[model samples]
Structure formats: structure tokens, C-alpha cells
Target: MLVKLGVNSGFGAKSCIYMLASSAVLRRQQLVIRCLGVGGYSNHNINTNQKPMQGVGFSSGASLEADVENVLRAITPTLDPNRHKGQAGNIAVIGGCREYTGAPYFAAISALKIGADLSHVFCTRDAASVIKSYSPELIVHPILEESYSVRDEDKSFILEKVLGEVDKWMERFDCLVIGPGLGRDPFLLDCVSKIIKHARQSNVPIVIDGDGLFLITNCLDLVSGYHLAVLTPNVNEYKRLVQKVLSCEVNDEDAREQLLSLAKRIGGVTILRKGKADLISDGEIVESVSIYGSPRRCGGQGDILSGSVAVFLSWARQIVTDENLSISSRNPTMLGCIAGSTLMRKAASLAFENKKRSTLTTDIIECLGRSLQDICPVP
Candidate 1:
């Protein structure tokens, strides 16, 4: 006896098992099921051979790649003549402290170069002037304070003030890239925690990178269970995350499985494990973007990635319901990571083609528009 089951969409665990059993028993059975699309199961010659049946549905990997170019093109909004300012996108980067300011500047500016309508930076007082001087296009806020500058008696008042400052503009932002040059200052990290919580409440998407990963690694509750949150961790950061969450070292052979489990353990927050081929996972599915990038290994490229992810993530959210794409099973955060990583690599590759060993973060950022246009043209 052979049974056949046809499914239109992908099969769940229970449905998959049922189809397998039916195919084994009824050799000449055929069943048509309605899923997301039209796919059926058929078994021939069940009398002599009783073999386990194979189930076929859309593979998550296939779905991701199938729509990569389309997703990139769709999320990239067109430059309409009727559209005014801020319609393209408004991005905010939440990092930059005394020790480092270039990271936040790289992140905020990259958004604008990638065609975002507005880009803002929230940084410590010591870092604000430096970042502002780097680019007058960004709206820099010098509201954050380090503990060294605050009195013990004024900690509570100062904390509230910082929170208030961030809260004022939190809602207006489409997405926030947390941690670029964010140093691990106790006071500053504390304020960032509040800001993260507020962004959660406001339902704003967050892309965590650099020291932001450090902050979240220590305090998992900051982004845990938030579907809109994305974490971009380099080799060291990924190792730390694996150790912190899974209590084990990195397993190169099972990288994709580990990334999937890590995302699941973090309660569905998306993660982009940066490496030779960037691996992205959103708890349920794992995908890789292996487009060849620059070999220069510049310092601030991750900052560019975080900012680019923020813009793409914002754009992805805008097109979520535009079409019933086969890739809809994956979260938009995961899609954004895939598209952002691909674009960054293409830009880096293009920049490296010209600059070779001297390909800096700025050089790669300069190539973003051309790289994007190459992959997905406007007209």
C-alpha cells in the first residue's frame, strides 16, 4: 500500500511524517494537498517494495537565494519625483564615546551614502564634536555622558536625563544601529540599556554590533525575544556568543546548526555571524551570503555593515506585504542581513579592485551606491 500527499506550501513536522508513512503503505497512492503552492506525492509499485517515501517542499536555503536579488531590488525604494525629504529612509546610530568616534561616524554616514534620506548619530559629548566635524550631513546629538564626568549624587538625575534625551527622538527613527564605537563605559552602557528598552517599546528595529554585542552578551534581556533585533558579530564576538549561550567553543563543521541554535536561544533575535561567508540565522532558518568581499580586513567595515543592515531592514519591512514571496517564511531581519551582507561585500570588492591594499572603510562606503546600482538598478 502506498499513499501520496500533495502539499502547496512547505510541510510542517507532523505533515511531513504523515506523507512519508502514506507513501510507504500505498505504493500506487496519490494525494494532492493545498499548501503555499502546488506539490504532490505519488508512490508507484507498492506491492513488492516497502521503502520510505521522500517528502519535497521548499528548502529554506533555496527560498533565501531565490529571492535575494528580488528582495534587494524591492526594498530599495525608487527615487520618485513626488517624494519629499525623509521619505527614502531615516536612520539613527547609537554609539560613539571618548575612545572611538570613527565607528559611529562610519555607520551614520554610510546610511546617507546608501541613499537614506536622513542619518542621525547619538553619541557622548566627547565624541560628538569629532563625529560632527567628520560630516555635517549627520544630525549629531551630544547627550550621552560617561561616569567619570558625573557626580555620585547626580547619577540618578543624570540617568533620567539621558533616557529622556534618547526618548525624545526614538519614535521618529525607523531603525537604530547600536554599538559602533560604543565603549564599555558603565554609565554609557546603562543609558544604552534604557534606550534599547525604549526602542523595544516603540517597536523600532535595532542592529547590534561591536561593543553593543558586549553589552547584550552580559545582559541578554536587552534584546532577548525581540524579533526585530539583529546582531552582527565578527569572529571573536561570535565565539563569545557561542560560549555565553551554548557553553561551548565554536564548531566550524556545524556552523550553520550552531548559528540556528544560537538565534533560537536568544529568543528569535536575528544574528549575522561575520566570517569568510557571512552566516545569518533567525532561530528557525540559517542562510549564508558568500559573495567575495575585500581582503583588506579594514577596521570599521563592520560599522558600515550595521548601518547598511539598518537601512535594508527598514526597507525590507516596508515591502513585507507587497508580494507573497516564497521567502516569506524567513523573518525580514534575516532577509535584511542577507541583502546587506551581499551589498557590502560587492562594494568592498569593488573598492578593493581600485584601492587594493589601501581599501579603507570610507573607500568601501563610497562604492555602495555603485555596487547597489550594479546589483539592482533604479530604472
Candidate 2:
């Protein structure tokens, strides 16, 4: 009956229904895109025959590692004295809990150190004060609530309040870095699901890492086919992702192809498989950023990548407009991942060059600006 009603509508009525459905889908898509600072349908080319621009391959002695450096140079916006605040970028990190606050702080502050104008953190009340205390520069929102704090009778009310807090500022953000220090609390995860849905509704780009990966691993629908989302996972996280999505063990020999397939299977969302050489793919093209990094595999480096990617991805989206160029074939998320991975590697290499055995995530973050300056020097 419902199917018959859907089908029996006049051709024009059917077209209207289709258009309405498409508009809703595109609206959700645009919410994320706009949050990343990219304009909507204006950038879409109806022809679908457009091609991407040609580029020089990564130089000799340059593996995916070398590619990262060059891509960083290519995408890092030149610092102009004339530009005002927020023009560079605005980013938010949506993680941090009782168990972990340093991760979100690391991710958010790193965005600032890397040149974003504003950085925000949305964390649990317990973690908020600590993260806020770590840096006066970040705008910390103490909104997330753990289950232990709320009674079952008030769950719906509390959930709505949490959603309201995040939703109020949803459209203002360019990108959200989810799952840094996010703990494995059932109630907290449920709240984050609502937050993800809101971000999706607002068209906000999301970079999932840390415990955020854990949430998505369990509920794949949250990010399944969202093209604007980027997932950064380490060796262990990658292994788990493979197991959950592919229902099998990791195959190192065909890692790149498998990663590529994973992104495709998940609806063209971008994935940055962090490893000896960070492998990135949007299911279509595979790229690697293997620049020499420190031997010291510190814990919070992935946080830096998540934050850095948010900024670069936002910038890439800003530049890939119809007015700027005719070729709209490229994926801004892919470009952002490429540029972010590249910059992080170069910074790590520079940090290692200086700090050597003493290198840390903070030290690498400190090198972000210098790395950018070295790659694409501003006048």
C-alpha cells in the first residue's frame, strides 16, 4: 500500500518526492561540508565527467613519506598578515573523560599550535576543568555526562540537555575531532552517538580516533557511508576495525588494498591507516605519507594527526569550490588526510632531529609551524 502510494504518484509528484529525499540526503551531506567550510551544491558539477588535476609524483628517495612533505607544502595555506582571526581555521575536539583528559587537550591545543585560529574541546564535566586548565587558549565545554551521574529516570532529559549543549554550537565549528581520551562508558558512548548524529545533521566533518574508533567499531551506521568523515586508527585499532568490518584477521601483505576496500565498503569515507608509513585511502585512490618519523612511538601522536587533519581538511574544503577551479572530482577529505599526514610526519622528523631520544608529542606539535614554514615559506 505504501509502496503503491509511492509509485502511483504522478511523474511530477514522484520527481518531487525524489527531490525531497535527495535534498534531505544532501542537506546532511552539506552540514558536514559547510562545517568544514566548503560551499554546497554550488561546488557540485552536474556533468560528472570532470577529472582531477595532474601533479608531479613524489620525488626519488621519497616514499609515501616524501609524498607527505610535498603534499603539506602544496596545501598549507600561506600566512597572510592581512587575514583576520578564524580565517585560518576553527577546530573542535570532542573527547576527554574521567580516565583521559590529556588526549583531547593534546589534540585541541595541537590544532592551535599548527595555526588554527580557534580550538575547542567538548568533554565530560570531570575532564573539562583539567583540559581547560592545561591551556587557556582552548574553549572547553563541560557537557558530556557519564551514566553513573544520571539516574535512569532522567536519562532522556539528560540526553536532551547534552545534545542541546553541543547542538547550540554545532554550526559554528569547522570540524570535530572525536574520541581522543573518550572513555568506554556505556552512557557516555550513547550520548556521543547523539552528538555524532547532530554533527551529521549539521554537516560537520568528523575525525574519529582513540575511543571514538571503539564507538564506531560497534555502531558502524554512525559513519558508514559519510564521505566527509575520516577515521585515524593505529596498528591495534586498525586490526580491530578489520576484524569488525571485514569479519576477519588483518592481512599485512595486502594492507593498502584492504584499506582501500574498507573505505569503499563503508561508503567512500576516508580512512588513514596509521603505521610505519601512514596509508590513506577514500576507496578510490591510495596514498602514503612515509616521511621519516621518530623511532619513539609516543601515545598521543595520533591526537596530533587528528587535530592537524581537521585543520587541513577544512582548508582543503575551502579551496575546492566551483569558483576556484573547474575540476571538482577530488575528495577534500582525502586531500586533507594527505596534507595532515604529511605535515605530522615532517614535524615528527624535525622534532626527532632536535629532541632525538627525548622527542614527545608536544615536541612534534611545536615543530608544526616550522615544518610548514620550511615546506611552504610565507613572505
Candidate 3:
């Protein structure tokens, strides 16, 4: 459901939300809404003609195309020769267990591919080496413990140890992507819950996806009112959120209103609802990135999005105070979702063009650079 944005006076009005549709309909149409400036309301409809995957430019007819372009350029950091290694972004993924490693790796590595300076993975020992073998670039920490590995008596000690390992570098990280391949081990999830609390306490932004969605759905307070938290949920996950929070079925008739209410009810966190068009909403405003992306619903695409959002959100947070940007929303989380959703759709379209039906998540990851370059060219 399409809805216009309303301006809110508060800085962190609500959470930014995006919904993705895993279908061919997502291939061409994209609409972006720029809710004027602070304390004012202006809605611009940037809808491209529905067509197959074309490169960066959508139908020239969409009037606000330049505004969308400006949003991406404004949030993305300029490459500087004198900057330190971690200046661009530092991202950590809190997931990966014996059964799942690729999700965390995808989430972590995508952050780097999208220009994050450093990417770290905190996972169980069983998955650490395998994920490391996947990429030597990642800094893998095998500190998490599943119930099977820890004695009942050691749970408390081990949990504190895990938190300590994370706390050492927590402040250094720009953002944290939680729940990539995190298995729902009672013990492991319990540990991750504490980690989430600490991240929140430290005021770090988090993008939650995959199994991470499962953890917060059951325990809403983990992310309940944190505006910096982003939840990326596909069809089923979105439905669950509707059930638990709104206590109703997925209301397609008034989805925009429902989404806005959901975000507000959850204490103003941004939600990216994954569907045909990536619909985003913070408690205060709702926006959409309807650009046509690939129809190939690969398993790890969401992981890529989670990682990409972490990087962009970090960048957005850094630039929120800059007076040069034209956009209105002071909410860095919303801007980050806009930038990340735009880039992901562009890369997906590019990958689908090259690999057709065989397109994998890795192919899309590889295209991130080219996509960013296309949108924000360097002088």
C-alpha cells in the first residue's frame, strides 16, 4: 500500500521501515518520497515506468529522481586519502553457529564491499573457521557458545565472557548487524539478547534480519523503542510482527497506516518490510524504494541487505548534523534505509542482467561497487 509521509518535529520520531517483495514486480517500478524539510510536509512521487531491469536511470519522467539521487550522494561518505582505516565504517555481525555460517559472512562482508572500513563476525567456534575460510578479509571471533558446548553451570560465566569480548570493541563499531545465521539456541540466543542490550546501551545502530528477527519477535523489549534499530522482515516475518504487535492479520487494505502504527507501537524503530516494493517507515514517516530488482530470491539476499544497511546507516548517522544536505528527515536511520534499499535494488538488477536466473547473492555483492559508482560518481 502506498502512503504519503507526514513531518514530525522530534529528531528520532520513529523507526525507519522497508518491506521487500520477492517477485518479478520489483523489477522496474520504484517510488521515493522526500518529506520536505523539518516541521514541513512535502511529498514527491518518483515512480519509474514499469519495465525490466535497466541500469541506474529509471524512466526520466519521474520528477523527483534527482532528489533520490541527492539522498544517496548526501549520506555516502567521500573517499579521502588522509582518513584512517575505520573512518568510513566499522561493522560487526552477531550471528553464525554450527548449522549456519554463510548468513553472518554475507552480512559482514557486504558491509566491507559497500565501503565499510572493517567487518567483524562474532559466532560460535563450530562456524568460525568455515566462515573464515570463506573470506580471509573478515575478523572472525569464535566467542559465542551454544547450549551443547557449555555446561549448565558455566552458562553465566560464559555469557559474561562473550559480552566482555564484544564490549571491548563495541564503541569502535559504527553499527551492528544482528541475527544473520544465529541459530535459536536457548543459551546462544540468551547471550545474543544481552549483547543486543549492550549495543543499545552504547547507542549503536542495529539492523536485524534472518533468525535475529525471530529473537526480537518473541522478546519485543529487546528492540521495542530503540529508534536506531532496523528490522528487515520478509513476508512471513512481517506477518508475525503484525500478529504480535498489532494483534491483527496483515492488513493489505491499509498497509501504510498499519505499518506506521506498528512502528510507533514498537517505540519508533524503523522497519523495512520486504515485499514487491521495499516499503520503509519510521514511526513518523513512510517511504518506498520501488525500483525493479532481480526476481531471483536467493537465500542470502536479506543478509546482504542487513549488512549494506548497517554501513549506510552508520554513514547516515555521521552526516545527520550536516547543514548542506537538502533532504528533510533528520532521522539518519530513515536516510540510511533509503540509501541502502536503493543500492541493493540497483545491484540486484545489475546481477540479474548479467547472470539471469543463475544470479546468486555473491554476484549481487560483487556488483555493489559498480552500482554505487553509477549513482555517486567521483570527480
Candidate 4:
């Protein structure tokens, strides 16, 4: 029975008064990556015999390794004295809740530390204070609400309110990082789904990670086929995504081919599969960054990667018309992933050198500037 309803339509299935929410199965379609690239970027497999980089060093001979450094230097904007605030980059992170405050803080602050002019975080009221306490440099909006604090009757109004708040600042952000420490709360996830929709409508690029991947795996419609989207998934997260989208186990022997297929299957959105060597694919080509990296398997590093990718991707997009980018048809999202992964690996290696086994995510964050400077110095 198709019941014609007005007020109940906007509210989801879980809304108060129990209204049926419409669900439509999105037909999977293959969409190509938008036409933006350097002329000659190549796909090269990781060289197992390649010696590890020493102390923020660049690979002297590996073509792919050298290509990564070149991409980083090319996309990173030069610091101009006349440039106004937010021109370098304005990154917004949409995550953080009662159970997770540090994740959002790490992602937001890392953006600023990596030279983004402004960094903002939208988190639950309970997390806003804690995140704010971590850094005065960040702009924290205590807007998102969790299930416990919100009554069902208020969910509709509250969801609209959340979207409105994000709408005000949506146009100002160069890029959005969608999941860091976001917990797996049903109501909060529902609100985030709406936010993702709004972001897509605005044509803004997003970096999905951590809990965002979880939200996306379940609702592939949220990000599937959005070329501006980039998903950074670790091992477990990648496994789930492959199973959900490709219906098969991860084939380590043909990891790049599988990643390529997975990206193509999802409509050309770039996927940065984090592992021993970060494998990046945008359905068109595959690139790997296996340079110097730390052996430490610490938490919060992925948050740092998500934030850094947001900045670099924004910068890459800003220079699409430059004639100097002749490496190949390297999409901006792919370039951002390569640069972010290389920088993260460099910083981690540096941190591990200093702190040894004591190296932490904070230590790695501290090394980002130095690592970048070593690769591409500010003249």
C-alpha cells in the first residue's frame, strides 16, 4: 500500500510516531574518474629489494618513489604573503562523540599542523569541550547529538538543525573528512548519512575513514559513484568493503588488480587501502608508496592520514590548470593519497627513530612539518 504522507517523509524509519521511510535500492553503475590529471603518472609495483629510506630521505632510483615526491612538491601551494586566511586550505572534520574525542581532535589538529589555514570539527556536545581542550587552533562546533541525549520526538527537528548548522559552513570548507573517532551509534549515523548527502549535493570532496567506512559499507549509496569521494580503509575495514562490494576475500597476490576492480565497481571513487605499502587506485590506475615507514602499529595514524589527505587534495584541485603537471593523467584525489601516504610514512619513520618503541601518534604528528620540509622546502 503506497500511503501518501508529507511530514513523515522527511523523518527516517526510526522517527517518532513510527512512519514508514522509503528505501530505494540504488542501481550500481560504473562512473569514470573526472578528467583531471598529470600527463605521465605510471603504475609500478612495490620493489621488495628497495632499501628503506633513511631519515626523511627520498628514493634515489625508484620511479614510483620519485614520482610521489614530485607530486607532493608540485601540488603543495607556495606560501604567499598576500594570500588571505583560508586560502591555503580550510578543512572541516565531521566526527567525534561521547565515546571518542581524541580521534576528531587528532584529525582536525593535524590539518592545521600540515598547513591548512583553518580546521573545524563538528562533534557531539560532550566531545566538543574535550576536543577544544586539545588545541586552541581548532574551531569546535558542539552540534551533533547522540541517541542517549536526544528524545525520539526531537529526532526530526534535531536532524534538520544539524544539517542547517553544517550548511552554514559547508561552502567555506575546501574539503571534508567524514569519520575519525565517530562511534557506531545508530541515531548519530543516521544524522551523518544526511550530512553526507548534503555534502554530495554541494559537490564537496570528502575523505572517509574509520567509522565512516563502517557507515559507508552498509549504505554504499552514500558514497558509491561520487568521484570526489576518497575512502581510506585499513585491513579490517578493507576486508569488509571488498566482501560487501566485490563479494570475495582479499586476494593478496593480485592486490592492485583487486583494488582497481573494487574502485571501478564502486564508480571510480579513489580507494587508499592502508597496509605495509599504501595501495591507491582510482579505477584508472594503481600507485603504491612503500618508502621508509615505522614498524610501530599505533592507533590514530589513520586519522592523521585522513586530515592530511583533505589538505593535499584541496591543494591538488586548486592547480588543475597548471601546465607543469605532465607526469600523466593523475587525478587530484590519487595525487592527494600518494602525497598523504608518503608524508605519513616519512613522519612515522622519523618518530620511530627518535622515540623508538615509544613512538606515538602525537609524535608522528609533530614530525609532519619536518618531513614535508625535507621533501619540499618552503623557499
Candidate 5:
């Protein structure tokens, strides 16, 4: 029987069987979400004062006037002695190349600081040692290959080897943070494409940012129609996506409508369009997290957002899908984006309060725990 074979087989064989079973379960989970729609827990008891956000120009807009702080508290699991490693979250960052290393480090480490039990970095050989030296906490794998190192004749073999390395641990990861410090090399992009495809096939949620946005923008089909996909695009990136998909520029006046259309065009994947006020939509409704962070235009903040989101979203997904957790919206991706954005902004504000104009990404990350505690105090 399949069960007997799985138990008797070696690690490789067992993993293959487990992955197949997990994929089937994930498909069923998505089916459940589709059936639930707006009939989630919030419908049972509506707050008269709190209003739902209506999606402008889209019939799917049942305005989700979500109390974000409540959603964050609802999803964050209590610290339990019964819980072991990887139970909280096991997140991975699929980036870090010769040209860039700090971005991936910021992301992978941010996931840990934000309460993920374990964090990992999958990068190139050249960047691995540097990334490892940055911190001893991360489990770093230098499995990625670029054009300079990969010869044309051996590209096929190298690509398979890279994918195999990731496949060994793919099923165990709760979420993947893609594109931070991921340089745009043709061969490297090709390999990353395969990884994204595999992740999509396995039904794992992915937070795409940095160069990852670049990859998905060109090939919208990679994330199109995949409900678990969350795209966190900054000003420039959002502009490109709007131009490419909707064939128009970013419309500030009709921001929510444009965002809703963009998500709809991409087959209902969630999008967090970052700016002074973060706008999130899943082609259903638009929600904004305008809690002011610092005015500092520092780099690497996006990495922090991406990593924080992966953990929160993973927790949100686990909680929502387990049994209807009490929250306004049913979409974990949207909730994750909201929580992550709110936390990031609060942390940034706190960091700026302390460091003033000198606030850096690390400073913001350090404020995450405190900001989270401020909103939802643990007993």
C-alpha cells in the first residue's frame, strides 16, 4: 500500500510520496477557501460600527473593514511548551548573489526576529560564505548558479542539481521570500523560474519582492491564477506591473480601483502596493495600512517587509485554514499583508523615534518585537 511503501522507503522516496500527498491536501484547502468566500466567521456576528471596505469598480468588493490589530492578535499563536522547532514557522529566502548579499540577510534574519522558529537562505556559492559570516543563526545553502559560472553546455545538468538541492527541503518550508538580492542573470533567472513553478505546484505560499517582482512581472502566468501568491511591489515595481498588465500608468486618484483591476488581471493574487499608505487588494476589496513610519527613504526596508510578511502570512494561513479563526476577512494573504505592513510601519516609526534620521532597516527590525507586543501583549 502507499502508506506502507512510504514508511519502508528511504528519505528520498519518502519525501517524494509526502510531497504528492501534501499537494493533494493543498488543492482541497484552496477549494475550501473558494467555497467559504464572504461566508467566513465575521459574517456570523457583524460589528454595527465597523464598516466593510467595498471594492470600487469590482462586484467582488465586500468591503472588509478589518480591525488589523485584532487580526494580528487572532493569528499569532501562543507560546506553548508542546510546540517544537518549525511549528511557529520555517521560512526560506531564495536570493543572494555575488552582486548583492545584504538584502537576503536582511530578509532571512528578519523572519527569525519576527518569530519564525527557523529561517534559511538559498543563494550562490560566492555569496554563501559572506551571508554565513553575517550571522550564525541562518541555515545557508549556496545552491544557486549564475551565467558567469554556469557554462552553456552544462546548464541543463546544473539547473537540475540546483532544483534537486531545493526540492529536498521544499515541502517542509511554510513560506518562501523570493527576489531579495536576486540579481537578474538569464541563467539564474531561468533556475529561479523552475523553483517558482515547483513552489506553485506544491501549493506553498510565496512573498515576491525585489527582483522577484521583476521575474513575475515579465511572466505574469507564473503567479497568475495562484491564490497563495502575494506580490509586494514598491513604487517603481508597481508602476511597471500596472503598465504591463493593465496597459496604463499608475492612477493616484483611483488607486483602489487600479489596484483591484491589477489583482483581478493577474487572476486574483493578492498585491501590497507600497507607498506612504500601503494599499492591499486581492481583486476583491482594497484595504490600506496608513500608520506612518519614518520619512527615511532607506533601502533594505522592503526586504524586512517581505520576510515579516512570510512569517505572518504563514501563521495566518495555518490559523485560518485550521478552523475558521475569528477575523473579518477569510483571505490569509490579505491579512498577512495587512499585519506585515502595519507592523513594519510601526517598527519604522519606533526606530525613527529612537534613531531619528539615522534609522536603518536593522533598527526597524529590532523594533518588530516591541511593536508587536505593544499591539498584542502576550501573557
Candidate 6:
């Protein structure tokens, strides 16, 4: 029993921990660890991914021709009963304002729908109540102040309060989805800057989208050299980022090279350029997820991608660190982009199949679970 306890404990576990080949074996191992007072074993191991073990792989294509599905299946944690809340993931979105509540809602709720345990939304006072009304599952915090609401003298005090509020919960979050419906309020953006700095200090991973892209574009220093940061940019946003960082136009002639340059220029932060084919880069390799997708042009799909990536990215990081999964692509952000983009496209296709041309973002969000289960069914 003492021998069992020692191995079951965190002590001398990692070597064998990474070698648990199949989910069935992984599950049995997890249960034994939990029952034997080896709480740490269960952590960073199971309760990620979807349903049962597929014992199968996924499809793919990229600059490196990555086996996207294989990587997805590999890093995805097996769903185990021993895991508890927040172990799967606790994601926070720092976006939403009077003008946009749905973006944040879509991002936050999508995180939960994708299997994140706790999803929090921190938005402006005007947007908080509306977002809360959208769903009771979110832990909405009305803590951000817009430029129109604050006076010049109160800026400093308000900034501190804003940062303090976020700092209180900063370390608790595994990943932050910044700028879903986040408006371009100077005061609010400034406060967000402080929050981003604090998150970086805490070593928290961040997925930036929407207005977060706007802020990071204007101030490249915000995410420069921070490998944990991920930027998801649509067409217009990508143009702005490209122009600002590379000081050049979007060159399809050398699209992959340009993306690699852009990521390298940004000090190796990951970039997911949203297009017909989502291209992902971490300054090292350029990968693409060009699976079959819906032709429907929707407004909020990017928000879903951001939230999805945040959760998957956190999981990929955990699994990569803890389990020696078969991933040639070592960068967690890249793995996340591949998984998030692939899953989003797959869900979008399924939603379009059902909703046809009227496939809205919510429809796509609704398809997330079913789509994942279809690819990797729950046992």
C-alpha cells in the first residue's frame, strides 16, 4: 500500500504519466490515482476533449501538412469522472459594452458549451446587465468604465479600481479571451492594457480578438514577445495588423511567408488569420485548417473561435506539459488554433446543414458539442 501510495502520488509519476497510451488505460490510471490519494495525477490528465475515446484520428492540411486531427485527438484530455469543476478549464472574457453584448456572450457561453467549467465575462456597466440577462451561467462582472462616463481627474483612480477588480480574479483564470464585444473606448482600453500587463505577469494565457486586436495593433508592445498571447484577426483586422506590423500589404503570393514574418515580427506570438482557410503561425511554422466549412458569412463566428481557442489552448498547454502526446507541433498556441479552427469549421458546416443559409452564430454554437461528439464520441 505504501508502494502504491508513493507511485500514486505526484512523486515519480511524470515518467509513467506521459506513457499512459490509451484513454481506457489513462482512465483506469486516473481512478487509481484518485482513490490512492494521488490527486495531482488526475489533474493535467483527464476531463478535456469530448465524450468517449475515439481510438481514431482526424483529417487535415497545412503549410507543414500537419495531421490536424491526430494532434487534436492526442492533446484532448479523456473525459474522466474523477475530475471536478475548473479542472477542465476556467475561462474569462474581457469584452462587451453598450454597443455589443452578443459578442461577449457568444464568446463566454461558447466556452462553457465547449466544456469549460466556469465562464466569466467582464464588461462595461452598460453591457453587464444585458449580458447577464442573456445567460445566468456566466459570472458577469460590471467593472469596466467607458471614456464617456469618466472625468479627466477620475481616470487614474478608475484605472486602479478596474485593474484591482480584475487582479482579484486574475490568477484564478486559466485563459483570458480579450476583446469580444469590447468597444474602442480609450479609457476602457487603457484599463484593459493594465489588465493585460497583469495577466502577463501572472503568466496567464490570453486569446485576443475584436477590439483586443485593435488595441494590440495600435500598441504592439502589449503582446510583443509574449508567446502565450494569441491574436485572431478577421479580414479587416488582419489588414490593419499586417499594415501596422509588417508595414506591407497582404501578399497572397507568399501568404505563408508573410504570416511567418508577421508572427516573428511580433516576437513569436501566435496569429490565426480568419479567412476561407484559417492560417495559423507561431513564427516557427505556418499551419492552415482548410476543412469543409459553411459558405454563410456571419458576423460573430470569430468570437466563437476566440473563446474556443482560449479553452482548447489552455488544455493543449496542460496536456503538452503533462502528457507526452504525439504532437510534432509543440507550440500550444498553434495546436490550439488548429483544434479551434478545425472544430469551428466542422460545427459551422453541421449548423449550415441544419439551418441552411440562415445559419447564425448561435446555430453554430449549438452545434459545437454535437460536432465534437461526432468527431470524437463520448464513451
Cα lDDT tens digits, model 6, 1-379, are 0001011223132223223222323454455556666466443444453333343232232222235655566556667677766767789999999899999999999899988999999999999999999999999999999999999999999999999999998766878999999999899999999899998877788999999999999999999988789999998999999999988999987888888889889987989999988888877677788888899988999999999999888777665543345343556787888888878888999999999988999999999998778765677
lDDT of 3 by residue, 71-176 (tens): 7777776675634566677899999999999999998989999899899999999999999999999999999999999999999999999999999988677789
Per candidate, the number of residue pairs that clash is: 14, 8, 28, 8, 4, 4
Off by over 4 Å in 4: 1-63
Q: Model 6 residue 326 lDDT?
A: 37
Residue 134 CA error for candidate 6 (Å)?
0.9
Candidate 5 CA-lDDT value: 0.79
Tens digits of per-residue lDDT for model 2 on 239-288? 99899888888898887778878887787678999998788877766767
Give per-residue CA lDDT, model 4, range 36-62, as digits (tens): 222211111011212122222234454
Q: Candidate 6 regions off by >4 Å? A: 1-38, 43-66, 322-324
State every prediction's TM-score relative to the real structure: 0.83, 0.82, 0.85, 0.84, 0.83, 0.85
Model 2 TM-score, 2 decimals = 0.82
lDDT of 5 by residue, 70-155 (tens): 56666666665544577678899999999999999999998998899999999999999999999999999999999999889999
Q: How well does candidate 2 match the true structure, expressed as C-alpha RMSD?
A: 8.9
Question: After TM-score superposition, what is the CA distance of residue 234 in candidate 2 from its true location, in Å?
Answer: 0.6
- Where in model 5 is the C-alpha error above 4 Å? 1-66, 321-327
Every model's Cα RMSD, please?
13.2, 8.9, 10.5, 13.4, 11.6, 8.8
lDDT of 3 at 180: 95
* Clash pairs for candidate 4: 38-328, 38-330, 39-327, 39-328, 40-327, 40-328, 41-327, 41-328
Residue 378 lDDT, candidate 3, scale 0-100: 66
List the global CA lDDT of all models: 0.78, 0.76, 0.79, 0.79, 0.79, 0.80
